[model samples]
Target chain A: MNATIKTLGLAAAVTLAAAPAMAQEKLKVGLLLTLSGPSAVLGQHARDGFQLAMKDLGGKLGGRDVEVIVVDDELKPDVAVTKVKGLIERDKVDFVVGPIFSNVAVATHKPIVDSKTFYISVNAGPSNLAGKSCNPYFFATSYQNDQNHEVLGKVAQDRGYKKVYLLAPNYQAGKDALAGFKRHYKGEIVEESYTPLNTLDFQSELAKIASMQPDAIFTFMPGGMGVNLVKQYRAAGLADRIPFLSAFTVDETNLPAQQDAAIGMLSGSNWAPNMDTPENKKFVAAFEAAYNTVPASYAMHSYDAALLIDAALKATGGMTDNKEALRAAIQKAEFKSLRGDFKFGANGFPIQDFYLVKAVKRPDGKLQTEIAEKVFDNYTDAYAKECAPTN
Target chain B: MTATLFFVQALNGLQFGLILFLIAAGLTLVFGVMDFINLAHGVQYMVGAYLVAAFSAWTGSFGWALLLALPSALVFGLLLEVLIFRHLYDRDHLDQVLATFGVILFLNQGVKFVWGAAPLSVSVPELLSGSVEIANGLLYPVYRLAIIAAGLLIAALLYVLVNHTRVGMLVRAGASNASMVSALGVNIQRLFMVVFGFGAMLAGFAGAMVAPILSVEPGMGDNILILAFVVIVIGGIGSIRGAFLAALLIGLVDTVGRSFAPNLLRLVLDPAAASQTGRAIAPMLIYIFMAAVLFFRPSGLFPVKR
Candidate 1:
């Protein structure tokens, strides 16, 4: 009887000793992004920004070592779902980040939410999640899909433009963008056209736009499509005559390829390479030194996501498995964002400032987007009001 | 105003069609003579563009880049032929397709590995930097005009090479009946290599020429490849003349259709519905045309064997 009691006492001691070691196990983060196809640059920039944040954090988040598993979705929603499932069921990640395009986000978000894994979207904040379907486990460090377009709409309204032509790729996000622009701008839209997603040539559309002769044109063609449109627009001599307004079209990733063609083009975003904040300045310098290129808005969002993650981790002492503690910590959002004065709305999307930027040539002969004016101050997405507080 | 717009639209259509022809010419010839389906042919166009971008950056002269890229593209084509394609010639169509699709996957990733994923731009040569007044009060880029001119020139050259020369006779005979050509004292393997190499160079030349206007990136040829297949199908397999006619037809239908479809539909449907349906129908116009042609003729408009 005394020997049995002593053995039980020894087993309890061993269990107590192993508990601390088990708590110190590395936290896993699954990064799902479209790292291939035409839009690979977007994913690459996002990854670079996220990795930069990790580097700055001394390769640790929340005082705990992190293991990041990056997977390419190839910009396909089905593939994204498969990879996200792998990340959840196979890798057993504590948190997930990214899937840059909106369609992929919509398809993959449900599983993450259902599985109760913490999700901080680096890019692609779809409206569906911001409204009735808002989940407590999901937070977006990026603006909702329509927020950037809403900034452009406000800019057009402020500028007193009487007639504007809107063009975008005919996809879910494109339609949402057009609707978002229409929501705020009360001007007479001369025409709105949605071209095929894979369209490389825009001559016919350009000719049509020229004939209509709107005061300004707003378009949302991302990736190589944007480069082709902007170049072709300049080649057609339309850029000199019409003001080109865009969202998510002109940025650091594509500006080098566009060169002089993107000059004088106006765009709206939440961040610019030249934003004058200490955190942004430091980020820009470190990013340029590391990648030899200016980080774009996508990168800025991703970097902010990493900082948010770090802040939450620190708040909870890296207790990622303690769901309630991690949730409360994430809700605090106490990170210095590259975008100044960042905070999340009730729907978990960013309520941040949006800036009107113009693509300009630097003295060094490199293309850079410079912030011209603030378009929105402390703006929350339109869908945020529709979201019932789940937290 | 309408007349000038129409003229420019027509010019745009013609330019697009000619570019399609340049890509389709090589593809159709290879398919016709070799009886092989080379899905990787599109990647050859992509390689051509990348080669021009890299060569232009290295040489700092577009003219020299073009002059140098042609032979390199030809050699690359021959190399691919000897390395992988030669082994697949005796295989069935499904096997050839599977093998070439693998090549497409390999080359697309290979380009990305070497060049990085960012889109690269090739500046227009100073000689072709500006627009020309192609019509009264109408201006078009000189580079586009140059592409159209170059494509036509190649078409004429191809006509001469395929219909006039001794080697051309062998190719035509081989296309009609490979066994008969092999029996007529012709080295069929050598003929196949020459045709394959020349076809690749043609596709590569198209890519290099358009590199300045298009964003040169990996997988760029994938879309154009599908369009080339449509062109060959409509023009009748293996017929250069057929490919040319079919390419122009598809291009005109696509450009003009996209530009006017909404307005035309607005006549019947509500404005909102018209635009939505128009946007949806524009891309399908050529495919619809291809289907209709195939339905009526059952062997395309100009099947070469017939």
Candidate 2:
């Protein structure tokens, strides 16, 4: 009898030893993105947007103190998995939201899914994950990678732009953007160009595209590269010679440097500063009032990401541990999106409006996204049809 | 392609090459002399551009902004050195890589935190604003040609300093053997600071010069950092002359290859295949060149003593 009691005691001790800390005083969150290098500008904006929402939440979420553990993936997939493991296993985060680059997300998705930790991506909706690879465990708070480009493609096609030259960085997101453009654009594509992922120089690509003498050039260079391309295009005197249609190319972040170059360029965007909505206006005013800066695209989506997470937690009645419940809550898209009427598709992407945004200098000497054009009032991504949710 | 179009494209290549050289000169120096790989070096360039934009606005003169931004860049470099880089001088390359990488994170965000993420423009001085008509029907922006001239002039100045000055002699000595330089009573530590500071300012100068043409924004330097790395690697980490040549080569290759790749492929394959292959190979061309150079000339085209 004494031995039996001792054995049971030993078993109990072993269980306690193996188990994770059960204090549960805080709900740890993991944020992974390219916090350094060229993409840092967007990453910084994202970080700000995420923190702004947390501040709005009075420094807590779901009645638990929030501890956000941010990691820099250095824009590498391997680094993403390593940092994510640290967050999930070591930090023991309750939920994970992050990884700006699509390739990084693709690399880290499997391990995260297997761990059963909810992944709410702030940006990058690679089509495969939105379709066949769709998992109940994953949700995207930002536009799917294809939606922006697809919208641009449709608009370009409608405009009867022939001999379009395609340009994007040589990376997974770039490839996806090209594929997305191809899905909607059926015009005679004169040529396609892929520059280095971190390349700032676009002169050669510019010259080559000019050589083709295309009616228009379509580009997907975001952040600084977008700015570089536009500025150089204007300097090269190609702006007047050709129509430069792009996806996520010129927005508030890039439009200022572009000046005259950005004036007539067309793009696809989910949120623009000029988007007229009470929610958008509130977001813009609050952001400008708070930071004294115009809101970039990153700020818009990342704010939505936080709100989406908050909505999921509230919908689940503040129960953070139930994965299925949280997934279902996110799928329902119960949050008040700054972008207006935001809902999640079966693929876990937004089923919201995709505006055909034009870059125009605001009367105040700063550039702004005016809704001079729009491709779809309510856009459904091309890959949504392919997502058989039930599997 | 028309001759005029090709000539314009070649000029574009030259302009791109010059910008690459400006960045690579500073980057390669740090790598070659200190054997330190700074990932945050790009942030230095970003700082340059921002300083130029803000100072130009504040001072209301491009000349003053240029003058003010140079010292600020040097001061910024010195601050970074004391704060983070000093500890990294003797650390392993991996740790140095990570820490400098951290500085990039802090500064990129810091810039956004202070200046915001929006792109800011530094207008080209009124003197150099318009375009210049070249050989045949090509009107090129005058600022671009000026950038090429500035880069070449800097290259010559760098060569003269390294090959013909007292500080240059000491720099060469330190790069060759820190132990010997120390034995010879040279202040190795101070020398390092000067090199680091000078390199930082040069990168900043590049940023300032380019800012008028390109938009100044956070994370502006990252792509140039990669190209600079490629130039240093291809040219030899410690050889400034090699950096000059390799910068031009990479700039021309990247620009020319990207332009001609599809057309070149069209000749060898069908139009569809050409476009696909060209798109696939264009970005890889420089990387392929780097790999080839590394394989053939392990230490680069010109390996410094260190």
Candidate 3:
């Protein structure tokens, strides 16, 4: 058994060594995301979007033949840590692009950054990374975690809502969502409730909402939880009585399942499929043609991440050896973002526009979010000032 | 909380409990009679939801979908039993666990391959689509109430089926001692198959009933599976009566505790601290209840007499 194992290991080593030498020098990218379980749709879209961008570039990034390794995080932090270590140590990827959810980002952030590898986030921009713990190697192609929720908070305040009930899955992101909402909406918070992550049933919580009859209800449920909550909220007849304001809960990832139940629901977002720009229009059309499903912000952000990498490589002339040069090029963000006017804050988070998007059923009978109104222009995150100049 | 809110919460608890009971009933019976730990039982529930969703889209009527889904779920359960599970019945518990876990992974991926990862929308039938006012200023969804009604009716049916039938007598006997039943000339293997399939259908039925309300997606059964296991363990591994009572206790504790935990804590702790601590503790309350139960009655509240 020992002799056979040794033989197999030698054969594997030869295979790994021969392929890269035979081919042109390839840029290896580790694409880590939650690709299983209920939230798998989010990661699937992100993967497809990144793949679409790669296809648009003739399967190359910055004129270099690229090899992408996709791994499923399974939305478990421990599982993510192990998988990311393999990508770093065994694969020796030049860049690590990943992580749909914030918890996984928090788990893999240190390991990827400490290895002197650039970590480009497609989604999941947790607040801590935008502040004291920010690393030069880490760059978020997505908006800061609090920005989308802050848009909803501002909308609620502008609409003159006196009291709003808030709900979110109890986790780091969930807490951040409520805090972001509270930052702008100074009206009385009628009540704040946090359900455990992935909770499907909201009957008890719905009962509480019915009794309170607050001016509006704000929530931050995503993926399957969002689908269930929207359907349940509609069934409970609260959608008609209370204004529903949210972020991520009523977006494209869930709109397909939500259908009529989610129509006219307002959500805060950085981009939507219906945003009117030639580049966005072309990207959205191509994405739908390839994937046959409307692209969510998750997909949009990931596509942008791929473009960001390509742009950085172009500036560096595809040379990945000089870490400082690559980091500087990525910080410049020299790409036409699908969302329009994208640039990085000092902390490597996006300084971009946010919108109060509303869900609508299109003429094609597909449900998606459309930009209802622009809420912020060139918005900078609250935590950016806390990021010290280290690089 | 006000009286009306308390009453509404209690109703929600009952509804949630009934769903838990439906899933736990099958799990307890299989564990008790076969002495086989089938971790893939949750996948059976997921399959049921998927089956109902598909039928609903194909037939364009939820009622017809449900009617067709029941028999289909039965066939699917029996198919799994024949294809994979029956062979493991005589194996040790650890081997059975590992094999069944593989089945769960395979089936979860299989469903995704067939249905795609995005949740399929299953609409509530028009007959039960709206909300009804239960009390002054209190409104509840008619569909949820329908679920509660259906759950109760099935519980009553299960009670009669398990207590009065000759097959049930053999099942109880088999749970006590399978070798004695075999020695008495009963085809104990066939009896095990029957018990296993019936339990799977019960779980599937629970899944079908909630398809309209829940996200009919892959791995949807995982969390509920944990809760169902807690119900069976707390109630007693084999006792139908114990499972029913314990399921209700767990459901109420989980639902009511989630809402009231912070309020109760606020009487002592500061509001922020109470809310944070409450959110942390509420999800764990059921396990705490299970632990407390095991401490008092290790074999469960209604352990089968060996």
Candidate 4:
């Protein structure tokens, strides 16, 4: 029995020694998203975009076999932390992505930073992390939370609106949005009302807005709340009388539900469906073919994140074990992004052009955003100045 | 202008209260009669909205969708009672809660699978598409007013069914003493099933009615479910009249508080502090009211003599 055991052990050692020479090392990517609750649609879009990018590369990153593990955070911060911990400890993922909401990002990113794993945020880019709290290993493929709203603020100011009523849900992101709007908007603020998140009815608030008689109404209600508010605003005969200006509220996800009510509504975003670019044209076509719906801004961000990772891997010649090479490659930002002129700013957030878009009826009678004008060129977040330069 | 704003807000409060009553009436009935704590009650409301949305698209008429969805919702509720809820009747409250909670998780995901995760919109029927002039220069959606009228009509119907009918007498007796009613040779299980099915249908009706005005998405019923519980507790569980008064009172307090709390607090506190506190306290007003009511009346405002 001793002779047989010695022979088996010798054989195992020989096979293990020869394994690395024959096959490349596997790259594990962990995706943490709010996949099962109220914000599930956002997560679904992110997942689809990531998968599409993988498919575009023929299911390999940097010529190395890849394994992706997706987890649902359920939109809870604590749940996000737990899932992220599991990703690092149990799954042993080298790279991490996702968490669509800012609050979830705040909770999940600290552990990733401590563990020294590469984190690419697909949706949320909170200001706290972009400024003094910035980490060397963190990058945001999406815009900083305030950048899109800043564009809307500038547009509203340029339109000569003297008095604007601001509305947002009561939360961290809501406060950030209002602050961003106030930065560039040089107008008299009529009223700033913070309604409870996920509120279905807005009649009372609409009544107040009507009484105040602001020149325009600016809001930041996202998801289903956005749909309800737009529908009710039109139903109340307020949409026509008062020009509506919003950010992240009248996007493709909720535009179908808003229908004619959304038409003529103005919003500012980094990427729209009708942007005239070859890369964007290819992305929108492939996404619609795969998902049978127009891809939203969240999906574009996730697609960009995957492409960014692929570019870094290729630049390093698939040497993921070399941390310095990988980080330098990502910072180079050489990938062709659907959003034109994409690059990483000092804060590791996107420096991309933002546009003023209006909801218009298409030839096919579908509601879609039509880019009216470029609002910002190679814009960086306010917190970029606070980030210390490492290079 | 202030007076006009006040009048409009009051009307909004009344409309919201009527919707709350519709949901709480059924919940209180099921809780009061069977002693079964079914946490999945909210999912029934969710199912109702999904069914209406699906049917409206297929049939291309809101009226047809309503006509078809109600019967389908009734059948669905009856099926649920027979398949899952019936086995849970004899179990303890904790077991019932666990089992029903499992149902909620299952059905919430089930709806998402059937109808994708995106929120669906049901267009208002052409007959009710226009706005009505409530006061001079004040236009309100006719659909919202229609919701109020329908809710009130259902409340009247429910009152008559519970107070002035044979089945209602059985329900009352069953609520008071289930074992004694069983001793009198009444099929108590059948009575329980009837109450459960009818209660579910009522909740479904409320969901279908609101689908056009509100976004019909998964988990939409969860928040309103808590508010309905507060309404039932404040009204005294098992009393339709209590549910009515408590629902309206809650609706008015919540609407008025949210609208004017900041202005009222500005009298004493700085504007910034007042607005912050007002937003923080608005969502809690119903719960505070519930605690106060329960403090004075432990059994609820109109607890039946069970």
What TM-score, over all chains together, does every model reach?
0.95, 0.77, 0.92, 0.94
lDDT string for model 4 (B29-61, tens) is 888888888788888888889899999999999
Which regions of candidate 2 are displaced past 4 Å? A1-34, A50-74, A82-95, A115-117, A256-261, A305-330, A333-335, B20-54, B71-121, B133-138, B152-204, B215-250, B276-306
TM-score order of candidates, best first?
1, 4, 3, 2
Q: Where in model 1 is the C-alpha error above 4 Å?
A: A1-23, B133-138
Output the number of the TM-score-best candidate: 1
Per-residue C-alpha lDDT of model 2 across residues A115-217, encoded as one tens digit per residue:
9888888887887888888887788878778888888788878888877888888887788888888888999887767777756667666656656688888
**Of models 1 and 4, which has the larger DockQ?**
1
Query: CA lDDT of B299 in candidate 1?
Result: 72
Instruction: Supply candidate 1's per-residue lDDT for A321.
Output: 64
CA lDDT, every model vs. true structure: 0.89, 0.80, 0.90, 0.88
How many clashing residue pairs, candidate 1? 1
TM-score of 1: 0.95
Native-to-model Cα distance after best TM-score fit, residue B161 in candidate 2, in Å: 7.3
| Candidate 1 vs 2: which has more TM-score | 1
lDDT sort, best first:
3, 1, 4, 2
> Which tens-of-lDDT digit does each residue in A69-150 have in candidate 4?
9999899999889989999999989889896998888888789988889999998999888988888789999988998899
lDDT (tens digit, per residue) of candidate 1 on A64-142: 7889999999989999999999999999999999979888888988999889898888888888889888888889888
Total clashes for model 2 = 1
lDDT of 3 by residue, A1-391 (tens): 3433454566667796664454346899999998888788899989999999999889899878899999999999999999999999999999999899889999999999999999989888888899999999999989789999999999999999998999999887888899999999999997889898888999889988888889999999988889999999988888888989999899888998999999999999899998889989999999999989899998888889889999998888777888999999999958989999899988999999999999999999999999999999999999999999874
Name the regions of candidate 3 deviating beyond 4 angstroms: A1-24, A78-82, A85-92, B264-277, B291-299
- Backbone clashes under 3 angstroms, per model: 1, 1, 0, 0
